[model samples]
Target: MNLATSPATQTAPATLTDFFLKWEKSQPEKIYLRQPVGDAFIDYTWAEVGQQARRMATYLQSLGLPHGSNIGLVSKNCAHWLIADLAIFFSGHVSVPFYATLNAGQIQQVMEHSGCQALFVGKLDDNPNRWAGMKPGVPAGVNLIGFPDYAAINDADLVPWDHIMATCDPLQAVYQPQPDDLYTIIYTSGTTGNPKGVMIDYRAVAEAVSHTSVIMKHNTPNARFFSYLPLCHVAERNVVQATSLATGGTVYFAESLETFAKNLAVAKPTHFLAVPRIWTKFQLGILAKMPQKKLDLFLKIPILSGIVKKKIREGLGLNEAVLILTGAAPMPKSLILWFRRLGIIIQEAYGMTENLGAVSMMPTNDIRDGSVGKVYPGMAVKIDPQTGEILTKSGWLMRGYYKEPTLTASVLQDGWLATGDVGTLDKDGYLTITGRVKEMYKTAKGEYIAPSQIEFGFADNMFVEQICVAGQHLPQPLALIVLSDMGRQAERIAVERSLEDTINALNPKLHNYERVRKVVIVRDPWTVDNNLMTPTMKIKRNVIEARYDAQLQPWYENDEVIIWE
Candidate 1:
């Protein structure tokens, strides 16, 4: 923050204002966001959105908050949230995105930790109570502004924030922001320990969008995008939001998790991004509705298999997505191939918050299994020979972790960020991620196990919802599985007997060390709110081990094939 004036850069001109300003001037009425309601959607044009953003920026400045202060936003995928984000930028402020899944305590922790000066509540989500039930009165610099819940935002009645936006001026201060300015502070959604805030800059975000849009072939206005992942993570913000803006693509935000598929069909998105867990769930839903035995028989038929798959593709709404991308977690190869069989190619991308979004992604045209495609346009990737760690260097790499110099130094060294993910580059330069160096565990007999590897093997299994490799310091690695809804429903009746038979049948084919000695079926689903998964939907090994540590004993004690009741 050296406010020093330079000779050539004497004018304190607007930062990256060129992108949006040009867009507003070009297609002012072109729809940018198509957010779905129950059966319909409300579309926001570029000019319309820009007008709202201007009002929001003026309203934000009217509060007399400090420049560059963090503003917390809690909501689901909605157009209003995105509107507020741009407004914050226009006013020269930072946005701290909070996962709507967190509990009250967690929300407070993240807000305070990120030093958020104000909070903007968009439409109520599943976890609305936690966000709304925070300490009652607004403080000196902190305020609550949720529309339809309170009076005018700028009035003495202390109206909600959105209400105030309606009356504010549509011409406020334009943020002449720079590339190096801090943009967001997102806390990791791991189960244990206080969440760690990862800080990144605007240039890193824009760079991620630029490269991703190119890789996805989304360079024009015709590219339609589906916004499903949490905007709190850089993955969604950079990939979906920034990419859409960079390419002039229209983004459609789903109403909720339950309406996701239906909304996808309605939007007919050309680009879609999803976490691996959701993809696995989609596989289960399709398999459960079909007669598995009969389907297997048809799959064996040379001609019938293609016919069956063609029908499945149309039903899944995947026939529209020109680029169906998967990341935020390691996707099982089985799941990808299952989609491929249906003529839906799910390409995988690899990266972390430290690298902005994706450092390397499987190109849409040259996709291959067990590989996260080629290094992105500007990213330089190198594998550590000694430890097999993946290292990346790029202009998009994060400026540094917020206020944690030592932590930042550890990851960023010699102009390269140590990814900590153990991976290798194939002869063709496609990256194959093996496992996390920290997540790899040793068995009682000193055998090493990569749990992600084992979990991917069972990803397409019809009965398994989630599988975590465990049994460290034991004779062998064991898998703790969370069964699918179909498998769980079947567990209490005659179906339980059939499912047990099916699960037992699949176990024998696994390698001796990889075979699940005890399958512990969990009642609860893994979620970001429960701390079992990351905000980006990655399974947190540490969280899984801690939550199920006690229950694992019964499996060892009873000598049971499946431990859960």
Candidate 2:
């Protein structure tokens, strides 16, 4: 299916692959990707990337799979991941990306659901046990191709990337897909149940990337992006991969979790996007070096403030960042204001996989205290008057949930994607998200409580790292918290006093039903490995509730304001 046959192509923007081919010819020698090796960097120029991708495309074509076959890409962020994606596009296949952190069961579930014909395994967890657990997830019939060994073990039976490059010639006939052709299937980070596969077409990708470029003011080729987040996620895929391809920007990949700070320092990315947890970690790291009281005192001095902010930015490897964004979850307003004091403006974006994650973004300037900025130019947003649910319509919305017509119809009705999030729009069109439609739970008092709104109240407390306000069928909501690094290191008496103070100050503001009955400091942290949190750092409310529901009554009955788990 070629673009020439479609009328939509006449006015539609160039697709991601189109931009790649353009760059391959126009500036073949320009550095396109910088991948870190231990203590050094391996740069891949446009020509180098093109050559490898074309060779891989030829190999994939030789497999004789049906056109538009679903190909699985399992990898952490690396140069080869992008190359493999391009190869999939050139070979006329739909790419299905799995989160690198997925366990064996999750890998098998997505692999089986997507019906992937081939799986490209690349950089994964450095821990051998993790990779061992994931290896069996690939079904027997699926062809396996392994990238150069970085962290994952490349079994002897799998075809090596080097072998394909040496044996296969560059594919002479490249597949040119139409605007409506399926591009990729992104699985949601399912917090509740099985993740749904969102099918996005080439036109949606083009529209999302192009519109986001304009919104971010990153149209120039000099833009630099750091790719550390899970590329499988829609936000990272659009903001980092597709945006870079469309804008002719350079992309840098982090080597590993241990070396993330070092790798980021080298990249000094012009545009950086991180989850709220990451921003909190950065804040905590800074505070560890210079206590908040001391830093506040320095910032009060006009001359010292500038120096302090500059040093902090450079230390965090964001000195060159023109745009820093946070999303995938609600960020605390207090955290945004705290960064502002350091001259760092965090633009909180709002979107989901169903909308190609391009519904709205906070403008660099004109940031509202509690709102997630205005809607995009080509997007239509309306709140369900009764439910306060945010519904959006856009040209770039996903085609549907892959192979789930019933589910697709439920969310995508009459061209409007029900965001499943409740929010209010101000007179000026700024959006303030109240809570998720499904996440809100009713207390025994019959009043519904929005955990997210109540959770935000504790964001200003540095002692709290992760929090979930969950108490369904209880008289009042209870706060389950994980202590921050600072909190863990502080004297227990000090930590308890601080948390008690936070609850006391916050409870007066909330309704009687919404007030937190007790503050439970969970001993174990929720992590992706433990399945308590999603890959993006969002706590799984259902999972958390199931784990602690039996003990909630006892904790509530206890007289202590702060209970240690």
Identify the candidate with maximal TM-score: 2
Error of 1 at 279 (Å): 1.4
Compared with the true structure, model 1 gives a TM-score of 0.88
Report the CA-based lDDT of candidate 1 relative to the real structure: 0.73
TM-score of each: 0.88, 0.97
Superposed Cα RMSD, model 2: 3.8
- In the range 299-406, model 1's lDDT, one tens digit per residue, is 889899988887776676666677788888888787788778667888888888788767777776677778887777667778887898888887677777776789
Worst 10 residues of 1 by lDDT: 1-10
- Score residue 559 of candidate 2 by CA lDDT: 92
Error of 1 at 508 (Å): 8.1
List of clashing residue pairs for candidate 2: none
